[model samples]
Target chain A: MVNERSGRAALAELVTSRSVLVCVGSGGVGKTSMAAALALEAARRGRRTIVVTIDPARRLADALGLERLGGEPLPITELIAASSGLRSGSSPTGSLHALMLDAKATFDDLVTRHATDRAQAERILANRFYHSISTTLSGTQEYMAAEKLGELHTSGRFDLIVVDTPPTRQALDFLDAPGQLARFLDHPAYRLMTGSGSAVSRVAGAAGKRLLRAAARLVGSVALDDAVEFFRAFEGLEAGFLTRALAVRDLLVSAQTGFVVVTSARPEPIAEAGYFLDRLAAQDIPVDAIVANRMTPRFTRLTAAELRRIAAAQDAGGDQVLRTGLAELIELTAAAEAEERALAPLHTGRAIPFQQGPFQQGPFQQVPFQQVPFQQVPLLDHDVHDLGGLEQLRQSAFDD
Target chain B: MDPSAFFTGTAVHLVAGKGGVGRTTLTAALGIAAARVGLEVLLVEIEGRGGLAAGFGHRALGYEETVLAERIRGRSLRAEDCLVEYLGGHGLGLLTRPMVDSGLVEVITRGTPGIKDILLLGKIRQLEQARCADVILVDTPASGHALSFLRSPQGLLDAIDNGPVNDQAVAALHLLQDAARCQVLLVTTPEETPVSETIETAYRLEDEIGLHLGPVLVNGVLARTPHRDTDTGHSNPDDPDPDDPDAEGRWVRELGIDRDLAHAVQQAAVFGRRRRDAQRRQVLRLTEQLPLPRLEVAHRPDGIDDLGALAEELLGGLRAW
Candidate 1:
């Protein structure tokens, strides 16, 4: 049997290995909390740490007890900084910082940083197609998240970085982004369509010399006209976007970065996690660990009457009622057992379950991590808007 | 439950809705329901949400179908992947690889204004032509794209007079036009935006694709009943009613509780029922305007997180239909 170490111990060992720690799972799964805890643990152990989150919820700020987070890394003043000042004899071993990504803002920054001139950046940003492509595009958000992660890591600011990835599909897109972006950048049709002259004016000139003329015609003259204008606006920065994408892909392949798949113990999530693992394996992305969040441990024995009562409750009328009162308990045990069985064969790491509780009024109370190791904090009955609430959250987080 | 009864055997199933309206959930549930009766099922997701993967709890899916549940399989089709593979098959493989390798594929796939929709429709066409599955559940992008996606084959067939592309487009149009072979379901929440978008999407898909529009799955509905007034004369929203009470006491006791909370709860229940009622009324209007059968899926509080739950909720009421 695997030893049940403290959350701090498990976190310290994971970060010390110099690998990428990718936190992924479904929405509302407390991925950000676990990521913050691990980063805090790492900082306490003397490693310079950064925990970045792409989830728009900003739960990280609540988890870290900060009023807000900037786009760039800021010192985690509430924990390490405060703890260090309390007692010189008990100085923190390391430093911690946090950053919350704004995807569109980051993409805009990339365009501005790489553009040949202010005029080009303005033009590209102004273009309707570019605007739509940058914001509404399916995987662009994930790609930009990965880009930011790589940028922070390569800057040499932190020894260990924890990325709280977006929801499942988007999280996978973080890995697939580089490849997908490369294809769009290199498509010859794009180059030809976006080339200097007006698509209509150059149609005949381009026809004899280029194969893309017919395809351009297929896209229609009006749309082709619009696409060429957008591309021309993006000309100066195309190469930079390409280069950054390549760098991010290389960093992902590096040994220093490891991905940790975080999920709940539910059958669906576990299966999704397994599928994610399979795809990662297929693509050769290094998976450092799988942390199954919100797992319920099974007791040695329960009376047959209790089991029957549980089964009877499963047949309850409403989906929410059944799920909360009965299905949840039964499914939790089954999921925990299933995850343990699945993780048994893996050579590198094991599974960790962070218990969860039913919803409560306060933001911290809403968080599942507070229930782990079992000393429950009374529900705050108010929203967590400032530093004090976060401190209470931290206390609850480490309650056991 | 005859598997074929769930689907209009001759119709192409186009599942569309606003984002987060649980379109993917409805599609997966429908697929499961159809599969349970032993129909060969092909479930498709176009937005690259891989929500189908989440719905079935798989890791990831590619262009090729992966078995999700018994008798059900699914695939995620992105415009870029389809273009690369299609181009490769047509001897332009080398030309597409560098772009694919550079991560431009996703951009090109999703970046082109209407290309993603076109490619998704094309992929569905291919699925329809193949005899591998008896029913194909297409979990399309949100209504914004879904309308354009359904209309794309027709648009392409009109644009390209005759060619291999046109040939495929025409075949797709044929499959889509065949009412017996294709159907469309609009998934929505009882909320204003989603319901409005659903109606608009339904009209556009029906007009353009000539497919049968099926049901609208209204998710996250609330239910409330009058509180039982105890003889001791106390009522708590948190506490369940002890037993049936007199009408006057029930009203008075319920009124004494938190007004806003009780009102909010009542509003949600009323809103949901009203939305369903409105949808049925609109369906009647639609039948008058453009004749077709319409169905409604009741709101389930827990929402659909998996195929089993989805199947039970969606098909549970189909026996009456």
Candidate 2:
């Protein structure tokens, strides 16, 4: 039998993620559910917690027993009481709140926060490119998510935040956006784009204008002028944007922040998880936990020899269809066994150190990385849609 | 709608689905299938997932296009290279090369999210216009991001009332919304979350984004597993009573495995049907609500491993549609 209690304890140890707990995984791997569930578990432990997600659908909201989600955190007191079948006075001591990201609103909020003046802020907000990007682009959500994180951290709203980054490539975009924006704020190119605010900007701005003129001849004068106007509106807000970006980046890799890399034991997700983990390790960001979600469960604990004995015994049975079923069962058990073997290392949270570069020129030697605490969320039968469902999910991941 | 109609005069195909729904596999399968039908095919992937190359049994592709199989070419769209291509399209290579060399392009595109998306989409438009292939197939980001990517040009247009950036967005909108030229295929697994997301994606792409809907391919569907699951919405002939005539009795006579093995088989059926039934309901819901055609691919116990298997599977899926 799978040791349910031990798995839960291992998972509980990682729950001490006091600052930020980021759950990263590929799409449709229960990453969002895990985020909210982790928050719920934290609250049950008497710790004030908030779950933040960019999930557009109502999955998180439904689990929190809310009709809809918005940018602000919605406390789940009523939902928790209802799930526990308790009256108001018997509510849990710790607070639980949830927030769904509003990308455009967050972007607009950032603009308002960073603008030099109301008029300049309005001008930038009205800029078609700014409007388009804030509302329609891929990175806007990630950028806003990161931006919101900084806000939550500074506000001192909760002791724990369970957040999930955007999926796949955007996960990197979320991580890299702060640095990119910070670098661009100080870059000569950005200075040129925004035009001269200082003596240095003047020299760079002149070169930038000539290049814009050159660029205008190719793309058309109208487009270049539009780009210039878009840049010009940001004349004095670079510092504000830069400070916040760097601050968020610092918070992400801080000691209090813990990352849990979620993936299935399947080959594809495991391989991708390995690459992502390596990227994290390369940056010196420690991952405290790993959740191998939705594994093909071991249906029976019978050993191979016992199975063989049963097979031979069943051959002389009465029902012909039962005989056929036996053969199919044998075939499936073998596959599951093989799958478990392939994913053995991941179950134990054993880190197999790998080199990033192919060549042998580096001073680094092959070394075993640290083992993270591990937990496996069983492949569940019912779809998660309610607060009670989340409790079931939590119990599956954590013994408590 | 006929499945082959998807190929007729369709210059751009955007394949989107939830993560791990086999978007890359379907894109490669389409590339191979199209090439086999005597059309040059170009498959492009963004975000450098290395899925496209791996799908075709080739090493991970770089920024440049490489031959994958007969009449098929694959390329991974990297932001840096796309920046070079974007400037080259403006015919300002000599002057702009220095900007790229100075890492100015990197800072600008990296900080600015839509610029990179534009560069990638612009490259696809170029391939479409240049007749580089009979059709260009793109394995786009997951549903939400794909929707944003499709709408990115609108952001540019809105940002620039008059400019080349505005013009680019206008042109992109022209191609993206022109139903005769573009067919967006939404792939999804038969799971609660993925199915709901797929339906949402379909609605947004059709109504909000204004793209032509291609056949929604419900992939990774479970094949027949031995057992009768009475609880499913779609009950099959294999319900577990021995008296059920259609049940395979002969195979039972040939059985020589233990009860644990039998239990595993029984559990696999229960597992398979839960998903199969889920997929069936979602697909039915999709077909019932939308005017789009639907196709089903039988789930291989082991998923689409490489190019050859996917190509074969794609044919079966297409035929089923």
Candidate 3:
């Protein structure tokens, strides 16, 4: 039911809109590629674009053909300066840039920025709970990703920004995390543990002193002394942590943000995507679109039986099907049809189905000095590392 | 039939729950327990989270089976790798890797919409048929996606009127239905969302796929204090008598704790017990709808880090069942 013109049309709409585009899905579903493609399409149409990826794997960099990215945004200079003569030397149109999120470092920066002093910052950092939360809390990385996206959006450097999210469930965590952190910050037990000494605090302190004496009598002074020191260190910065947690909560529930659930025709990912969409709706987050990637193109003249026979023969160790490969033809056609059907309901914006490439084993060895067209780039071997690779990937995103 | 009777067969046991609910950890534990009882087990994970390997404390697992412990092995079920291996073994290795590569495997596997589910199920079926394992413990995707995977074959069969895929679909369905061969165990935490999802998944599997649902393993269940009367007729230790001034004195004297500290401890303990009782109510609700046993695995204070704790908690007392 998708309008033939809708894919490019949707990209154009996104180019002009001021809203944020958040791409979310399960791992290995071509989400990164789709985000790049959207960003590329926007840039080609003369809109300034930036695509940010929180994927730890340098797939975005490989897709963009960049060597590496830091915390800050880097210009995708190669794509703009390509000598291919197809479209070279910074078209008077616009520009594209990309950045990968380093969540732990970003969180560390946030703590330092928000803390009152060096002692307070170090105290918060040194807390076992904070260290565990900052590094390994299940959803902390994804939340940090959203925080980075918000930072980029606030900068006003680009007309459009496409964010490729982490795994689906974790991405939802990004949506829910600020609230969870707020609850932890506001817990009564946390208040009792951290507040300046009051009536309850005096009582708790007297009880603690007696408990320590009893513990010293039973298990020796060393263990009790260590515990007392740990508790004492926690008393300094409870208010500051609570304040920052509240600020982050406010930042999340703000406007100017949107989500797009990206998925393929595969059942599990589609189902997960649908679940995510439902959750997003429940949370009042706006889902602008669902991008179904790698749809199979329908073919003519080949019946299902004929395709099966070819597959069966191919399975039986025949080279005829492999050389001419009616099976591949059949598979491609079936994929297109499956994608169309799977994405039939979400045809409101656009359902761009780029041909899905195979999983790459490792990084590419050669650097192509010349302009490499996206389609001719190795289907399986190439990794999306930088802006050049992303631009090449973007070039391959249309009806061609 | 006894609900647990489903466990004593050549069945594909799918462990499904919400994220962060110890589904993967439980799957590994079930595999180890089943293996110890002499069932050759293949623990499968589709998410590529490396949870299986991490749970079993293995370095890493691949598309091929890697032995983690005695009789318990792990495999990463990559659809493309499986197709490539099947094709190469069957003599289509001559096909250009690109033609086989560029979404061809995914198309054939993922064609017919839910065909990927059928393919994944087919892969599991092949492993079962090859006597690769007596029990295939699938660390399935989360509830929604897991249901989709289970319902995929039926989805395709319904969509396509008749075809080679349909034939394959029917065969897969037959394999799933023979409860003597394959069974599904719904795993859940005692939270509102995961428990609700588990109940819905059970009904959907039964209604749609005709697969026999097994026991609901409610992991991380809280434990409550046993109620008893003291000499003073304080019927519930949780319920303090404000009328009896001696009650407070007695509590402080007996536990040798301050009134405030004792009150805090009592409140925390009571809160935990009440939470568990609420969870038990949900479990009882599930029992009313499905003719399945509910196994409660009590919450460990430190949390489940590896499979060993899982075995002790899940299978340690199952002899009574």
Best by lDDT: 2
State the C-alpha lDDT per candidate. 0.57, 0.68, 0.57
**Model 3: lDDT to the true structure:** 0.57
TM-score of each: 0.55, 0.85, 0.47
lDDT tens readout by residue for model 2, B179-237: 87788999987666677678778888877768888878877765544454533447656
Best by TM-score: 2
Give one digit per residue, the lDDT tens place, for model 2 in A271-292: 5566566667767787677787
Candidate 1 residue-wise lDDT at B288 = 51
Q: Candidate 3 chain B: minimum summed lDDT over ten consecutive residues — where?
A: B103-112
Of the two candidates 1 and 3, the one with more favorable TM-score, higher being better, is 1
**What would the TM-score be for candidate 2 when compared with the true structure?**
0.85
Best by DockQ: 2
Candidate 3 lDDT by residue in tens digits, B169-286: 6778888888878888888766544555577778888888898777788886644333323222223545532234454355467635356533433333333334445666566666
Off by over 4 Å in 3: A1-5, A46-48, A82-93, A126-128, A195-255, A301-303, A306-323, A335-389, A396-400, B1-38, B42-321
Task: Name the candidate, 2 or 3, with the larger DockQ value.
Answer: 2
Worst 10 residues of 3 chain A by lDDT: A369-378
